[model samples]
Target: MWLKRFGGGCSREKLRSILETPDGELIIVGGKSHGNNQYKCTFEFYDDAWILKVDADNGAKIWEKTYGGRNYEHFEDIVKNPNGGYYAIGTACNKKNPPWGGDYCAKNKSALWMKFDDSGNSLGKKHFTNGPNQTGFSITNTSSGGTAWVGESKKLVGSKWQYKAIFYKLTGTKVNYSKVVDLGGWNATSIELTKDGGFIIAAGKNVFKTDSDMKIPALEK
Candidate 1:
């Protein structure tokens, strides 16, 4: 394996996904400074997801977008849309001293999804959580003018953590949401829609199948 290094003063932290822009620019999607730090004072250093556009010709920074609060955040994947826009996916924590809906996630973690134009202006966002804890890792643009996000949902089933695969489809601009399709058990690692209007999803136990109606079932154990 060959490792090509970018000769620059690089910031250290947890790095995630990367995408290529239509104008031949390199878009790097990852997190900011992470790990243990002292003198910086008191708690674990939180990392936020960032988008850095590098000029392919000179390997120089063109622009960057950091998405997060003082808490932890990270982007798992990014997709370029047909309309010269981009989508970024990740997870975040709820820092509210008093959260809405009296949900457990008010004290736990939640998923985050964001979309932006080529110029780095945010278009909108989609967040998913079952009140207490949830997270999304993969995202894809749909042919039907929307997008899909895949991830795992963690909920307190009695006293144990129940892991379930989740898929959310975004439909409108006025805050309309798609039905949260539950894939029963197992963790969904990634999801991709096919040209035939079906979906292929890889989870921990097996590869599942979802029809155009978005009803998915595990094909194997």
Candidate 2:
């Protein structure tokens, strides 16, 4: 057995998700600092979402890709598309706060989804904003050749702040369904494609079963 390492000249780096392609290649996605090696104790750091394609046998790096703006972009989850490509979900933050107001810029985070070709080239990208801040946690390929993802968001309700889970379905660049469901203020951690052409969302102590249309028809504790 052997160990392999990959990174830039940054002080911090992390790998969030890993997937094996149909041909046995490995794809890893995460975030890494784009700044210099100068270590800082504060939270002020510039980073970019990083994607790497490696040979499964020898762990050799085939290609690398980074996505970001002048701010930070952290990728949390990635899935291999059926069409010989990939889909990644995460959060993208810039210098400007969200237009919804109410301290959205306090964190400057928004839901981000990006599509990449087999060669690690970006095909398209989308930013989703349901409230002040939203961050995608998981993404899965749908049975209809589309994609579905779930995340957490903070919204204002009755002069108070409330947390909710947001779900979205996309087909090629079109949004099929976008729903915000309140799950008792618990963060929706992960989502999976069920065998019955549906989805199961795991949040805190509850599991939500949604139909093909992503409607919560049953909730399990």
Candidate 3:
């Protein structure tokens, strides 16, 4: 095998999510690879959510900020909200708790939702436990204020394995979580608000709508 090494300059792979601002600035969030992956099983390794302002002209980095705990944080997606600010969905594990604490770890994984202001400062961060593995897929703004996140919840029921499409909505400064919507065996992957003020959530093998009530229809491949 041919081995390649960097003399002195070295950079690791990064997972990135991007959002376009109203003024056309691009906002990127992802984790910076901490040198080599060798330190993971030993030292604390983190893939933080970092913001980068890139020049749309030459695709050069203008500004960037890294946000996360001393754990694994990877942003799956980013969205620009109607009220400004940006929302990100991802998973983090082995982290601290409360005002951003907790190793909400499970099977070596944890579900995470992190929000940031226009300036890249973290507005709020929350973690959810779903047995071992869980991840946040998408986020959308709610007309009623606050935001909504959809993802899959993997857990167990007796001796059987169960997967659920879960929804969580947060409101106010306290960010009180609303009751989760169980899509029964469905896995929610993407969420959007329909024109009628209803929510259209695409769950595995199914698409659903909820407007004070819930109804699901099979989505054909």
lDDT of each: 0.66, 0.80, 0.62
Higher-TM-score candidate of 2 and 3: 2
lDDT of 2 by residue, 1-221 (tens): 55688876444678889999888989999887765234422132356788999999899999898988544687899998887899999888744523422432445568889999998899999888877778899999898999999988886668877788888888876889887777789878788889998998887787888888887745322
Instruction: Put down candidate 1 lDDT per residue, 1-221, tens digits, no spaces.
Output: 23334312235554567777898888877666432233222122255667778887777778877776655666777888777788888787755442322342333777778888897777887666755666777877766766777787777778777777776766533223333335566767787888977677787767766775556543222
Q: Would you estimate the TM-scores of all the predictions?
A: 0.76, 0.84, 0.71
How far is 15's C-alpha from truth in model 2 (Å)? 0.5
Evaluate candidate 2 by giving its C-alpha RMSD to the native, one decimal.
4.2
lDDT of 1: 0.66
**Over the stretch 55-169, how does candidate 3's per-residue lDDT look in tens digits?**
6655666667776665566676787767768878777763344222233244355667777777767888877765566777777776676667778777666877577776666
Ranking by TM-score: 2, 1, 3
Best by lDDT: 2
Once fitted onto the true fold, the runs of candidate 1 whose alpha carbons sit more than 4 angstroms away are 1-12, 34-45, 97-107, 156-160, 172-185, 217-221
Clash number for candidate 2: 0
On the 0 to 100 scale, the lDDT of residue 18 in model 1 is: 74
Model 2 bad stretches (over 4 Å)? 9-11, 36-45, 94-106, 155-162, 218-221
